[model samples]
Target: MTGGTYTLLVEVPEATTISVGALGDQQFPAGWYAYTGSALGTGGFGRVDRHYELAAGDRETRHWHIDYLLGHPESRIRGDVRTPDSDIECAVASGLPEGPVDGFGASDCDCESHLAYAETGAELQTAVADAHRQARSE
Candidate 1:
């Protein structure tokens, strides 16, 4: 199994409010979002696939904070960046811009959030890639 840290690039078409599990209802502006997390569990990177399923409406279970956002009808998975065989989830997440929802996906760590947001896909994508590169070098 190939386990590592990964970031999911998400696009929200318009302003929307979604109840994010324990985080409750949170506002997400229309823009791009980057959610970072580790796939180091026994399931490995298969966790990423499950996220895709949620975004595609093929899955309904919301186990993680990211799942709640991805499950939203307006949320789309634009792309993803990955750093295989490494556990740099917090590093990469810390490198990106702060997310709207505090504690989103950082329940198990010290990070304020494992999610970040930007007004454009290009900006967030570039940030995600750079975060991965920076995390890997450390």
Candidate 2:
């Protein structure tokens, strides 16, 4: 396994299309996330924190399919960092030191790092939008 982990921001009540089989009922309305067991850049925790801090700004808002499933009002983060063993995480670990991530929305591109420093509500919205756009495109 690779020495990497994924941080994800999922919306509550949203169903994530993670290759980890099925989320079942443990769905999140809206929040940041990092899949467990995957190598991450310098500020892995900081990046995910930006997606949660309410003051992160609007740019970090939710927009991906999982976020859409979560919808509005659910953007409020509801849980702590969760680590699950899934195919997605496993895949990510397989390719460490690659600089870019495979299953991650903002993998190796700008989209992935732009939200690393969500400091205001507006920035959060924009960051979320960026991830959402990336998710949709993929």
Candidate 3:
């Protein structure tokens, strides 16, 4: 619907926040999070970025709802990239996170739209193992 940069920002479990440029300024708290959707929404990048901004005067930034609900466990942001082409959305739908996304449903990139999601510690580890298994099979 608009010409702009679109990217996904995921919060790695108590580790680090991985930003693909769509979300800016604010940082993601230590936890798993996946944001997929329009970067052109109101407040745009600021809205999503603020998700990680620890409340003023707070020791930890885990005061947000997502963080509180997740119980601040160790995890990582796990995801893959692809151009938004024919059937790309359907292909990535299964890759989305298990929770609600604070923004739109897809990211508009140069080659195509991209999708991403976060995973818990165990989930991240399992995904890694699965990748290895697939690699070995190949």
Candidate 4:
């Protein structure tokens, strides 16, 4: 679907630090991350597909903070939780636990950070999916 909010579930196999554009260097522990974002622009959810491409090493241009993490060969997109036709990016993000980075994926908004992290993939995925469902229900 188009024009919605989504949370990308990403996995980093090993701990490493990457420099996010303008955000400076940040350390990412090997685990799972849930990044929430909005797709309300002209292209809508096409942005999500582009993210997948970046994770797959098919795209090189880093347009967003998430791009930097996804670009790492060891980091990959595992899945996504979407709320089609919904505009609850902040709500969903707020519901998730705090992330290591202070402003990851939240340059345009006031969220502490749109990315949340967990020690395991299952924990992060459950939290991300539940957050989206809770936000959409509200």
Candidate 5:
């Protein structure tokens, strides 16, 4: 499968809490978020497409922890950084600043969390890009 790692830059306009499936209720501060994930399965990058759909309110199924956050009314996808043909999800996630919500989108890995938060979209976007670049270099 031609899969890779990707970081979705999400924005939360207002602070709120959402129920993340088995993760239960979690707090989310108002800010920009970077969620790193792997698309190494047979569907490959299709998973990223699904995330956008969910964020756009086109989809209702919540299969991942990120979905819960993205499904929130005030949350939307700002952009994404992708490292094609690379499985550096964990590396990229660890490269960015730590996320406040523990275990978000990190059910399968050893990462503290696959989600990072920043007070501004620009800052989070830059961090996500840097993480992707660093992961690619490594």
Candidate 6:
């Protein structure tokens, strides 16, 4: 599937503050994070693969706000909730709870933020999955 909306499930093993380009240094606690994004351009869902590489230390360039978090050695991409052939980035993000960082991935959109944080992986995953489902049904 390609050209869709996706939510990445990430885990931060330890607390740390990182500089997120123009967003400046933001504190991230040790926990799970869900980042929603759209892949409607040329490569489509292939963008998720690039994200995987970035999180795995196989890539270096930091192109997006999420890149800053993914680039950290302690952070990793666990899984993702994808809505193939759908474009509901903002809707899905809105359904989830607000994240710690403001304007994290909504520079081009009106979303308060596209990243959500949770105390556990299960909680984050459930929230992301439910958000996607709700967005898709709409």
- TM-score of each candidate structure, all chains considered together: 0.99, 0.29, 0.28, 0.97, 0.96, 0.97
User: lDDT of candidate 5 vs native?
Assistant: 0.89
Tens-digit lDDT string for candidate 1 (36-117)? 9999999999999999998999988889999999999999999899899999999999999999999999999999999899
Q: What do the candidate models score in CA lDDT, each in turn?
A: 0.95, 0.34, 0.35, 0.92, 0.89, 0.92
Tally clashing residue pairs in candidate 5: 0
Q: Report the poorest 10 consecutive residues by lDDT, candidate 3.
A: 80-89
Q: What TM value does model 5 have? A: 0.96
Off by over 4 Å in 3: 1-39, 55-138
lDDT of 4 by residue, 20-77 (tens): 9999999999899999999999899999999999999899999999999999888989
Candidate 4 pairs with clashing backbones: none
Report the lDDT of model 3 for residue 24. Answer: 28
The residue ranges of model 2 lying beyond 4 angstroms of the native Cα positions read 1-39, 54-71, 82-88, 91-138
* Candidate 5 structure quality by residue, lDDT tens digits, 65-90: 99999899999898888888998999
Q: Considering summed lDDT, which 10 consecutive residues are worst modelled in model 6?
A: 1-10
Error of 5 at 8 (Å): 0.3
Q: Between candidates 2 and 5, which one is better according to lDDT?
A: 5
- The candidate scoring highest on lDDT is 1
Please, what are the lDDT tens digits per residue for candidate 6 over residues 1-138?
468999999999899998999999999989999999999998998999999999989999999999999998889899998899999999999999778999999999988999999989988788888899999999
Residue 68's lDDT in candidate 6: 96
Q: What is the RMSD of candidate 2?
A: 14.9
> For all the candidates, what are their Cα RMSDs to the real structure?
0.5, 14.9, 11.6, 0.9, 1.1, 0.9
Better of 3 and 5 by lDDT: 5
Off by over 4 Å in 5: none
